[model samples]
Target: MRQEDIWDADTAARYDTPGTGMFAPDVVGPAVDRLAALAGGGRALEFAIGTGRVAVPLAARGVPVTGIELSQAMLQRLREKADEAAIPVVVGDMATATAPGEYTLVYLVYNTISNLLTQAEQVACFRNAARHLAPGGRFVIELEVPDLRRLPPGQPAVVFAAEPGYLGVDTFDVLQQHLVSHHFTFDPLITGDRQARVGRSPHRYIWPAELDLMGQLAGFDLESRHADWRGTEFTADSPGHVSVYRTAGKPVSSGP
Candidate 1:
């Protein structure tokens, strides 16, 4: 089945785990603030802007925002929150979709780049972001580095989360550089708890340096990379990075 189909209406309706996980106010605030500052009074575009988790608030902050999303169900949820005029969106692949205007900022958050599933596709996504960028505009990405270091040799999978009625795990295909994440959530014990809910998403994991090369191939220069939206320094131990790449010209302002 197509990956987009996995996010059907049933899944999209509950996609927002607000005030928890990535949707928490503390998490969303810093990312929007950083993105807004980088936009510098110019427009911003989002790739796979799922459920307007970041777009709506960023738009509320007065920056024009547009999006390209593959899942119609996800787009429906976004539209329910904000009118089309407030946050215009294109319904298509992020690697190939086009909105009507050039933008100062284009970003993919929550490691969404991995959803492309191939090196060439990921590179195409970079070129696509560059395509929408005005000269001197910036492209930003929030991505998690592969957690292979923690995977014991000969082990093909790792469990990252385990709690009351919830479990999350990732299985790796080392030869193909692919990973599939499995999420399982069970109903409360009081509800008989027989029917379990589950979902899986596959991705092509990539390295930070590899992405820099992709950026270069797409006419962007590496500008900044931080461990988080709060500007923490990235290190060998950092599990993720928020990277900014700029078109080969002076931007309206220094992008974070």
Candidate 2:
């Protein structure tokens, strides 16, 4: 199925887990804090701003926010939280679509950029973010560093999350830098039976150095990188990173 189909209405309807999971205040609060600070009192733009997860709260912090999203279903979910005046969104591919007005901050969180699934598209995404950003503006991305080290020799899969009734695993193809995240949920039915649901999404994993090269190609300077939203130190041992890039000039196809 197409990536759009994978994030259909049904998926959007069940995407939020209020007060828990990704929606937990601890998770969302720090992210909003960091993004708001990066916005520096100027307008902000979110790429793949699904369901107003961070936008709504960031707006509550007084930043003018706009969004570009591919999934209409997810946009609908965002509308339920904030109207067009509060958070206007353009429906199209974030790598190519343009939203009105310049922004001091352009952000893609939760590893959404990986959803583009290819190197060219991901590079385009950085360029697009640069396009929307004002001079001196910043582009931030929260992404996991590929977890290939966690996989046992000759093994392609690694378990990342295991909760009471949910499991998250990632299978990798190092040759292609391809990853498919598999989610399995077990829910107890009214009849005391457990129902199982499975989901899989493909992503192209980029390493830190490769991400920096993409930024350079798009005329951005790597400003700072942290291990988390709280501004923890980033190290080789870190599982993920929050990278901040400042726009410097027009993108270039070839290095100088």
Candidate 3:
């Protein structure tokens, strides 16, 4: 399926929960703080900057921010929060789209890179980030470590999250390095019935080592990797990681 169809208007409309989930202050604050520091008074480019979640806050924190997003629905939501002057965005696939100017920091947060769904595309994304960065600039990615360990011997599915109103399951196609996340949200109806809303999106899960190789091919060197946006040490047992890659050699100009 096309990526845009997956993140349609309905999904964009309910994407942000101001003070909860991924939008929680504690969740967003550290990320903004880290990205802002990475920007170091220079510009930042965010891949798949949905609803201005990080870009808006990062921009407000005095960091110049630009975005490349494939979903017009998502970009529309971001536009509602900030005008073009505040945060300019290019509407196209993050893997190939070019946003003018070199950036000190390029970031893809919240496992958004996995949305590429193919090794080639994921590799191209790293190259794209490199193309937009200034010398010594860093490209940061927030991604989940594959949860194959949680899947039983022959099982292809695992439950990643189970909360009051939400249930998230990931089914893997190990052969293809592909996985589809299924989300089911329960809402209570006035008639004492619970309405269920379901959504699914495909992703290509990449091992840290594999991701490092991709970065290397894109002329990047792994600088640091942490458990989360807080900069905690990453361990084998960690469920996810935030990796930083510094570009090697000179920057590749992204023409206007």
Candidate 4:
């Protein structure tokens, strides 16, 4: 499937449906709250803000939010949600999109950075976030910790059974730093009723140290890194990585 297919209107509609929106309140909401506190009461920008999942709630908390999204379909749903919640958004690619003004907080949550799929693109995303931040502003990122250890010896696929006759299979190509997932549904009685839907979401998993290096390269200081929204210690076994970086101040270069 093409990369653009992932953000089609059908997919956007499915995003908020039951079982699909499972991680929204539990994982995304708290993280937005944390980032809002770090913003110090100024405007905020969200990169790849699909469907306004976190952005709408953040705006509800009185933190002004502006979003940059790549897909018009996804942005349509975001605008629908924003209309319901009375928020505003911008449409563009997160890696290079620029907001109207500097923000105290800039964030990309839920592994959205992985959508970039390459080292160069992810680095450029970091630089873009740095450019949008006001002096001393913070850029927050939330992503799942890469689980390389899950891959079995001499095998490339890991199966996660979501329910009976439903499986989420992940294929990892370590050499290329890419991963693809297939969602399969099977018929209990007639095997021919089975169907497979493939989602080719490529990602370049970076370790926490690598992310820190990227932040430094973008002229930001690593202020804090947490394991989860509650601010737990970050370790190798942590399920998620939450990082906060402060933009370097005066005499330091700021880009357009």
Candidate 5:
């Protein structure tokens, strides 16, 4: 299924897991800290700003913010958190939608880039971000590295997470660079007992190196890359990364 279709009323409702790894203070603190510093006291934009998980707090940090999102259900949740004036959002595809004005920083966080199911769309996303950014502005992305090494020689699927209440697995189509993450969750919604829920989202996973090439194609230069928001070194074992790509034609400060 398409990425846009994956985020419906149901998914949007539960997107922000308050106590989960994403929303915890430690995780949120570092991410906002890094992004705000990159914003450089100017306007910021978010691609696929679902539920305002990071946008809300970043705006609270005194940066004017805008967003482009395809899912109205997700936008509805964001609206509940912040007024439209505080965070203006365009309801359209991130790969093509244009938010009002230019920004100093444009960020797609938490593996959102994978949402675009094709390489062409992903490249367009880079160009779209470049168009919205002011000269010298930066484009930031937080994404997970594909875990294909875990797949046995002939296997194209792997179950990464299995627990008492949840199960998560990923299947890969190496030839097409496509992946689908499957999730099964248990909750007690009725009868005060366990209720089973299932979800899946398809993605075209791009490698870190390929992503850099995409940035270059969109007139960007790689500024920095880290294993996390805290700027840890990205080593072989790192599962995800935070990358910053500055527009090449303009002079941007390469600093911490």
Candidate 6:
């Protein structure tokens, strides 16, 4: 399946349907708060804002948030939620989207960076974010720690079941640093009973050190790193990785 198809309207509408909000509150909310504090009460940009889960709450806290999203369906859901809660958003691709003005804080939350399938696209995302940030502004990213070492040698697929009857089978192409997960639903009636709901999301997982290199390439300095939203110590065993980067005076011409 194509990358664009995974986040299209139909998929976006089902984003928060069931068994998906676990990470949103515990992981995403506090991270956004930290990013907002870094912004020092100025305007902020949320890359890949889906359904306004984090954006709406952040806006309710009195922070004016401008969201950039590629899926019209996701943006539509976001707009509906925003209208109910009164927030604003911008619809576009995150790797290349340009906002109206420089922001004090630019953030890509919920492992959204992995949505970009290649290193070049991910680097472009950092560069584009730098372009939208004012001098001294911060760019925050939240992602899951890639567990490449856990994969058994010669095994190409790993099964991840978030719950009974709902499975995500992940296939990795190590040479390309690309991974795709097929979401399978056990219930066939809603989806023909015998057939599963298949959705593929392509991702490129980068380590904290690699992300730091990307930040340096984008003319940003690593400000802080955290294990979770509550500012826990970041260690090798941490489940989540949070990194805050400060936009330096200028942009870097090259690197990856």
Off by over 4 Å in 1: 189-192, 254-256
- Candidate 1 lDDT, tens digit per residue, 54-76? 99999999999999999999999
TM-score (C-alpha) between model 1 and the true structure: 0.96
Displacement of the residue 108 alpha carbon in candidate 2, Å: 0.6
Deviation (Å) of 150 in candidate 5 = 0.8
Global lDDT of each model?
A: 0.92, 0.90, 0.90, 0.77, 0.90, 0.79
TM-score of each: 0.96, 0.94, 0.94, 0.88, 0.95, 0.89
Model 4 misplaced regions, further than 4 Å:
18-24, 84-86, 185-192, 250-256
Model 2's lDDT to the true fold?
A: 0.90
Candidate 5 vs candidate 6: the lDDT winner is 5
Query: Please, what are the lDDT tens digits per residue for candidate 6 over residues 131-197?
Result: 9888888888989887777678999888866786698788988888778878988776578757777
Candidate 6 all-Cα RMSD: 4.4
Q: List the residue pairs that clash in candidate 5.
A: none
Q: Compare the candidates by lDDT and give the number of the best one.
A: 1
Residue 59 CA displacement from its true place in model 5, Å: 0.4
Error of 1 at 249 (Å): 2.1
Please give the lDDT score at residue 88 for candidate 3: 93
Writing each residue's lDDT as its tens digit, candidate 5 over 165-212 gives 788989989999998899988766622365668899988998999999
The per-prediction CA RMSD against the true structure, in angstroms, equals 1.5, 4.2, 3.5, 4.3, 1.7, 4.4
Candidate 6 wrong stretches, greater than 4 Å: 17-20, 23-25, 84-86, 249-256
The candidate that achieves the highest TM-score relative to the unseen native structure = 1
| Candidate 4, residue 126: how far the Cα is off, in Å | 0.5
Poorest stretch of ten by lDDT in candidate 2: 247-256
